[model samples]
Target chain A: MYDDRKYTEENMPKTGILLEVENTELKDINFGLVTAARDTGANEVLAFTTEELGTEAQNDLARYGVSQLIRLRTDSADITSSPDNCAAACVQAAREYGLEYCLGLATAFGRDIFARMAALLDVELAADVLQIDFKAKTAVKSHFSGKTMATVSLQETPGLLTVRPNAISPVEQPATLESSVFQADIQSQAKVAVKEIKTSDDRKMDLTEAPIIITGGRPIGKPENYAMLQECADVLGGAVGASRAAVDAGYAPHSMQVGQTGKTVSPNLYLACGVSGAVQHFAGMKTSKVIVGINKDKDAPIFEKCDYGIVGDMFEVVPALTKALQQEKQG
Target chain B: MQIYVCLKHVPDTAANITLKGQADYEAGAVKFVANPYDEYAVEEAVQLVEKDGSGEVVLVTLGPSEAVTTLRSSLAMGATRGLLVKTDEKFCDSKTTARALHAAILQDGSPDLIFTGKVAVDTEGSQTPYRLARLFDLPVANEVSALAINDGSAVAERELGAGNREVLEMKTPCVIGTTKGLNEPRYPKFPDIMKAKKKEIKELALADLDPALDPRPNLGKLEPVPERSGATMMEGSVEESVAQLIRTLKEGKML
Candidate 1:
């Protein structure tokens, strides 16, 4: 029941979804892509990238019989790194193939680049889509705004969508991946230029690339306590994270928030300390390799979701846990 | 370096989601205003040109012709000019709206920079800016908390999860969608308001741009969220309230 006009065979790929392979060494190419394709019906299917996990990542997609592997070949040296250019390349490929849908990782670049691409194509973009259903000539994506899931539909053709990275599971097998070269017409009246590139760490760990994450929430009480989370992250050799509530309340900066309005992460280990598990917050980190919740409230939602749960005062629990970890290291 | 700031006339953030028969709220009844996050983006564009003192700042919006009210507001806040991509009210989704902007930007020629809010308050779906960047194949920075431009280059600080930050550098002809922390947007002044009336405000349509591209994902069921019961004010001190709140969160499995 998908729109016949939008899903026409001429647009074989539908929308050309964009994914950037950044710091391949720090990440696994094993992407958990969720897409609503015309050939596959409306059921959300998984896809993979070739950057992080490499050819092995495609093996994971193979399991999803419906999965299609899109190997984005970038002139490694000419990488723009800007989301705008990355999106442009994707759009060009999509348009060239007459695809009706474009997808992207709901990462930092995904948010910034998709806005401009949607504007350029004059299409409404569904951001951080967690669930997508296509039926009766419409594509619906469920997302969270303030409190609840806001299901949006694209009534138009050639729509753009971005999903949180870990929202969908990566298929463990490969599909018949169609290969094509999408070379951007760099001379096409580009509105932006890359003047320079700078990284916070000449070799600093990327939050998304980290194996372990320690996210704090409003329960941290004050901004000063953020250092405590840092202390724990230091012990774990992980990156620090935050929830949107903590950021909006000024307990920490917005970049640190990890929720529906913030960043989605899937580290090998995610330690949510003093974080009250709001649905929005949970939506972002639900796919972590392993979860550990430390909250005084024994009934915390995180306890149900996490593999390990510790109910106690965080101020007392954190220092003791740090000391214990330190002792483990010393011993 | 001519700059364009796209603005959306949206509902205020404080507006509560009212329910209808425990299923859906009447979105039509919601009051709409210029999106707050977009205000910061518009402010950044205007401020960038003003601070640079060598470029023009133009504001753009794609709503009903009445969107002129929003466009004029941008002019009043020091935009050099404004463009209205007029369309029927029902075509307010990101795709059609973005087309109108692309048309206006194309007609206006290549601007050195484009700016928009991270997401519209009314729609609350943050994806248009990136799409536009892809279409134009321009560089972009989103949710930028801080920015600086000099000569033909610009620098921005992007907020990452957990007190983390990334600094980006881009050439001109970039797009920046901002969050609230970028800067405090200025209100309209009488002098500026008078000048805004005299500034040019052009109106165009989807047809005026390239043929309208087909839209993906048609919306089906529109329903409102269920209302929560009235919150109980805890008659206790901070310590007690924290404990009680923790208990309630635990009971709800939210803690």
Candidate 2:
């Protein structure tokens, strides 16, 4: 057990954040993870990355209180191709640094690597946590799809946790940065290899990572109607989403759907256009910082749950909103 | 060929979950259903076996006896039989759960393929299938949106973030975690539901598998998510509402 009084300013717990990269750039969500690590206050934050950490990336991470950046290297195999190798490399780094806590985002890659880490280390993993208290070795996580929250206590050493993206507000805490590299000894061959990665023609950001999203509902009569929402999304530097009803009606694909059965998104702003706001859809995005519902039906369930409600026909409201945003940008 | 589909009985996504105490819930009235993602796995398993014309789909779950309902539902959807690893423990960490599942699978005999939901909705522990893969030394794919099986091998496609898809091929006796967009799960017909009542549901105690593990992460407190209040209704013409929204976004510095 850790003594709370022993954590002085000079001797604090060390937190290792598993950084994620997308398209050769550091993922924006890692900033929030760094901030959450710092908020624990008992830890000196360091970042570990498997991806190449250029000078610019190190500088970016330093601004978020990362005092050191350790890049894991493999001599034999590409770590990115195999999650087992990646987890092995991470475990090596954690052991080398004597890290007391390991943190990561609860995304596809994080889920893959951390599970392996938990198995290898024989430690408990608190997956997709919403809040954490390092001193108490406890975390709060949502259960039953956000309907309830449970506080969990870690019974082992070197706590392992993966937090939901955008759950913590990012705060800038600049620190002097240092960098190092460690090569891990990985012996296991990759059982499953990523043979090919096919990118879709849609170049817009994904709804899960978008800072803002505009979602259409069943009232979107046809597929082309999504163009309007796309235009508005473009103005806001956001992405276009759809309710399950709209996807079922062929107005959009399942990838664009945002509901319980679809992607769960936590954006700064979510504009629901013409959605009746079923509980299933709300469960996916209830954690969004702000929800704005626009619907013709005044009694729609979405109105009661959203931070702002506009009772109006979406056909008229969305176009006007887009025009206003465009003019605002130009002016 | 033999196929196994792992199922978990979770609180219905629509259930109004209420906390009963610091580490418990008022689950007496809550209804449990086959996790929606696991339903996709069940459907895919049935389709694969039916296509082969010489295989059976087995449904397995680790939960209390009431979880038999979940297995029966899968049986109704065309599974050949069911297995329930009965346990009275209220909570088990993902690793322990995986150990139990691994023991159960070994006891029942290894299959050519295994299917599970990518993540359970209640715990959202997306670790079971991968842990099982490691335990059995089998290749595994997760969040698989498409799958094709041939003689002794299988091809799977997993959806990556940012609208990308990764195609992978692995040998047989592999594990696959099914996600949405895999297939439309069939609704069980009345006749099938009636037949499911008579389907064999083998029960085993925790001691039967005798998994050597301990629950690590333990639950501490349970609480309802704090509700968001103070919604401002925008009551105005179309142009006015749009203007107000723009102004509000600017004030929030979100524009």
Candidate 3:
């Protein structure tokens, strides 16, 4: 059902990826974005960044088939602090490079910039898209919190797409990397200026980016019981999450809640402890490579959805699993 | 000062959303509620107006006549009045919707501020506020978790994911798309609900607004997500299960 024809270099579409940077380092999510762009059968994949690309960033992006790295710079305004200015610069770059498609990860920053770019270019934007077919100028996105999926086609040129993070897996296709700097001469008309950025003091990995995640449900009687899951999470280098029921019960904050109304996570391994396997919670983590459910009820819905199931009290199963992993590490 | 807050009626978050056909949903069993994120915007607008002790919070929506129910709910929560841009179109893209809203706002006299949810729960398109901002040539701050308004300027904080936030300052006459954690929305009292029924709801048609606007980004096909099946149920003690899981993960080089 998918198009398998390969495009020759002469007629290939040029795809530009808006690279994200955090703490002067490139985010690993960009590699996946680069791969997604290349998967569109683009002849040339370009990485656009407001930050200075070091050797490591260049090496990493090149491994994902990014052929060109363009540093978008402007003396008129601080692109990092002004989203309008940043988007203006990106639009200028896209125009100058004759880009047919511009892709970005659908994080807060990407959503902000791409919205502005779409407006400035007077083009249509597909936000939080799951799949894109560049040749057809079409994309598929989830509607109603993922209950329904819609395929939308952009008739306008320079199709702008913001892909949900982790929606696409990264693939390695080494390319010869060439770098250049583009200084956009656009004037900034931004009324909003970012004055400060505050990072949370808690150093735990973000649930969305964690390799492994252990989530608790309503069965977690009290907030203190989360400590047991935290122990297992620490040993596995994962993050601790809670179901919507747990959050509604005031056992955890919304930031740590995983469900249709909360954060959507795609991890390598998801351990659902005492969860009833409500569709709401399952929708958020169904993309996990492996789902393991621990519940005392043999008929719990989670068991049917999980790769591995254990019919036991979470109070008994969680601690035993933590201890076993700890001993295994020590041995 | 005047504030315009855009609202959308969406299916309840817990409701089971079923597809009726390729491009529509079965609304028979689903209950519609005010978009949760938009409630934050309405609450923020009400708080800002109440803080100033003078001003009006006008609710606006672009949908069918049934959307008036959503506007009434917002009015019950303390909005001054509402404007419903009634459209017969089954679906309107963000850009077209923004243009219609822009025309309506201009017809009502440009307000000092505009508020909308960061994204609609139904469509999940987080573009209306930004598109409106651009069409009106106004500055905007989206996904604002915290907000403060002063004489002619405002300061807002946007969550940047991963527990980071950026503090931003923008002038009035700008658009702000509110996110969660901005403020708790208050439930309307019985008396207010009764009064909201009588409040004025001015309905306008798309043709009544700027006729130049046309919907773009046409929808092609819609299909239900395929079901995921085939999960193996482990049969063993807790220790045995953990051991087997670990061994399998190790063999696959996933751990």
My TM-score estimates for the predictions, one after another, are: 0.65, 0.95, 0.93
The per-residue C-alpha lDDT of model 2 at residue A15 equals: 89
Clashing pairs in 3: none
Give the per-residue lDDT of model 2 (tens digit) for A162-195.
Answer: 9888888788888778888888887866777777
The alpha-carbon lDDT assigned to residue A82 of candidate 1 equals 46
Residues B1-255 of candidate 1 have per-residue lDDT tens digits of 688888886544445456454224545666666777788887888777777778888888877766787777778888888887766553255555665687788888778889998776555677567656666766667787888887777788776533456777777677788886798789888998998999999887756666664333334444443332222332243344444533543454422
The sequence of per-residue lDDT tens digits that candidate 2 reaches over residues B19-75 is: 675667666688989989999999999998888898888888988889998788789
Writing each residue's lDDT as its tens digit, candidate 1 over A109-197 gives: 66666666666566667776655564543433332244334556655556667765555544343345543344455433334444444
Show pairs that collide, candidate 2. B22-B221, B22-B222
* TM-score of candidate 1 against the unseen true structure: 0.65
Give DockQ for candidates 1 onward, in order: 0.19, 0.71, 0.65
Judging by lDDT, tell me the better candidate of 1 and 3.
3
Model 2 chain B scores worst on lDDT over the 10 consecutive residues at: B208-217
Query: Per-residue CA lDDT of candidate 3, range B1-255, in tens?
Result: 699998887788778877776677777578888888999999999988898899999998888888898889889999999999888665688888888888898899768999999988777888898889998888899988899888788899987765778999988888999977798899999999999999999999887786776655377876776655735665577788778878877877668
iRMS, model 1 (angstroms): 8.2
TM-score, chain B, predicted structure 1: 0.84
Judged by DockQ cut-offs, is candidate 3 incorrect, acceptable, medium or high? medium
The lDDT of each candidate is 0.62, 0.84, 0.85
